[model samples]
Target: MKKIILLSFLAIICSTTGCKKFLDKVPSSFVAPENYFNNEKEVNTALNGVYDILSREQTFGGQLPIRHAVSTDESFFSYASFPTGPFYYNFGADDATIRDLWRYLYDGIERANVLLANLDKANMDEGKKSVVKGETLFLRAFYYFILVQNWGGVPLKLTPTTSINNVNIPRNSVKEVYDQILKDMVEAEGLVKKISDIGFGGRVSKSAVRGILARVCLNMAGYPLNDVAKFKDAATWAAKVNEYGEHALNPDYSQVFINLCKDQYDIKESIFEAELYGSNSDAFREGGRIGNENGVKCSASTDLIPTVGFAYGFVSTTRKLYTSYEYNATDASKRDLRRDWAIATYTLNASGVKANIAATNIYARNCAKWRREYEVVTPKNKNYTSTNFQILRYADVLLMLAEAENEVNNGPNATAVNALNEVRRRGYGKLLAGATNPANADYPGAISLSKAAFLKVIQDERARELCFEGLRKSDLIRWGIFVNTMQATATEFTTYAAMTTTIYKNARDAAQRVTATHLLYPIPILEMSLNKAMVQNEGY
Candidate 1:
């Protein structure tokens, strides 16, 4: 669907811009806007081009696999080869992944610009027009946000067309990118509507936009980059979500990832997520909407076993993170069932494997959070895994709100508990459907908290609730303990084993510990090669 639309965009864009069919699909020529927006289908096809860019792996599918994996200790990485697994796994910036990420995200920006610039000219149903326009704006902001966060200051291009007359540009400051992000969010918030729009599986919704706004503000509130003044604003955005009352916590943590993973558009806890689709009913795969077919891939997760990091066996877990769990053996044996969800941290089938079955061989603490949708088909389809990428979840919103409230109200207020406990209640199979803050136990005005003390709880709560969702690295960074915590973890984790019952090997080492260069990702080589105006990030 997206590929067909992209070709249309190329054909039309080339015809109008006098671009020779450099890629064959787009003819070198120029066609005026008047000719392009002749009808709704044409307008929609153009809009779909914006969606197509997102389907590129750099934006979601491919890049996610890198950012989510490299930024943490989910696996042991090797950095020996100049630009292969060894290079990237070692946090080296000159790798293909980094370069590809740069090209892909910018490609997304270009696609968005083309769609947005001509959207207003399209004569489509008002509702459909608004939805498409709103989604493009939201997605543009999203791709830029990824660039800003990962690449720091980046070239901020909101409009389309890069003719010889308009090619010169410079990297915008991070603050500028952020300001643009907020602007896009505000616009999107007004435009987004129903969660279930026709074929809008991954389209931005009002809740999703608001959710990202809240996250943007929350990230601004933490330390070195303390936009402390935004804490109140953050609370306000989160409160709007709470007041709107459309989403709520999922009762079971496991359910959040499994059965209910799809249709996460307006999930109570889901803020933003990347969408993946298996093209054919064969369930193998076409190509992802994210265009992941572009390159060589690495192990899906950091090693999960306690053995050798790259052996594709054990996915090691740090002992410190494992022991953080508080067990209550006296009561219902399922104390801290959330621990089970952290696949690399606990034993699932601890009993001796029954001798006759394959079940016994299934011993590893690695993340079981995957799917085997395809048995055969494309080569990549065979290695294809069913783990959907999640960007923002509501629990993070509640916790962020709790932190913001604790800051604004100056302590763990009843409101903070209401937000915090709402998430936990779901964990315990409880719902806040009709319950009010302060519960029945405490008076609202009487509760409060000290900033210092409150921050500690908020940090712990983030870890307890969002352990392996790829926020660990950033959370520690936000809290100012990223280096200390990660290094200590690697030390204690050196001898750690992924499974208790299975005897494993190879994971004994002190290879890729957190370092100074890790503060930011390096600029991709392709960006430098393609965009002469681009600059490499520090220490690449």
Candidate 2:
């Protein structure tokens, strides 16, 4: 995966993040598909264009992770000014953010379609060519997966868009869209390389494909499409990753995220992540607001900026996430260590020093998972830092298997219990990657519990382990408890928690605004106006 330079428009433009802009434009000097991809080099260039979408502001780079994904039970937008935005659950079809997200996803799919349609034109080795084709197919399926989950059913375009005149297409059913996704991913499983061969988390690997396949199956088993049979398939795919024995959880829970911040690849723990590098200081605009938007709040003093970097800390942790971890009354080591690291207990002062936050002030703490102070890039930009964001990891795979196996068996078996307990052991600092465990943190009580009771454990454990990683809102929605969870959190903020007037209003209003319509965003106004076949989501 050559990630530094993303070339698009058939190699006519070469920029660190050029394909995002190229998608919206018809280059005056057009390079036809037949004119390019005459060699392996050109074929690889087209594949880079497909991967570039993951770095765009509309996808994993910024908007998806920072703004759209944070407003959940675990966290919320800290500022109170913007009442008509997706973060506050007050946006509509006319919202710019919603429009951009819809367009960029289709743009990524189009890139993949062109590459897949023209891959064999290049004179390349059969082995290498197959890998590229597999990657492109997986990416196309992944883009449609995002669309189907967010908008219920979007226009499905499989072939390349040859003309601007033939753009109006009808929406596919949710089941039809998911079937295509599974079809592509199941084929990709046999063609992609192993994580051990890649030795990095940026590119798609056999493990990544399997892990994400499990996730897609779990989504189908829940929510609007209650295909209960997919639970067995989900468990099967997740078990394949664990059976491979190539990935494991890094003993320390915080190090899994810190490895991402430092641009270090721990393939054993991190299965796949978005590659972000080089703040514009070096003339490459590839960096994103992963650290700046969700990190600890900092004053932009020249003295403090040099060491600690700058962050708006717009996303704040909620009391629900704070209390999810086990707390020991007197002993600190006996407690789960994830709470303090995921939720910031301190802020950086102007003097580049750590100022401890008071214990009573829980709601004001920032999302501390991706702290900018640990970024290794020199002269970091205030608005963007070179911090890569994790999309899939080994811990998530374990949890998915546990959840699926529970549903399939009507209760948790030993394999399911052990898979989940492995993550818990590391969260308690009882298990290291290779060292022998001195004490086991396995839940002895969970073994005898009913299926309903054990599902609750999986839910709380996911919030405790994977918080602020951009998966909470979707997880809540898939479980069919998103609206209830938001309404419950809103009541908790107003009735029980100690909060200031403005914080109470902002937090309560955002949660209470969620309705049945919010499960999926409405069709963007621009899209509806342009595509005659499009219909708006209900209650929008």
Winning model by lDDT: 2
Score every model by TM-score.
0.75, 0.95
User: Stretches of candidate 2 above 4 Å error?
Assistant: 1-4, 8-29, 433-440, 497-500
Report model 1's TM-score to 2 decimal places. Answer: 0.75
Cα lDDT, all candidates: 0.53, 0.82
Worst 10 residues of 2 by lDDT: 13-22
- What is the C-alpha local distance difference test score of candidate 2? 0.82
lDDT of 2 by residue, 439-527 (tens): 45677677677888888899988999998888999899999999999999898788755556675678788899899989999888766
Error of 2 at 443 (Å): 1.9
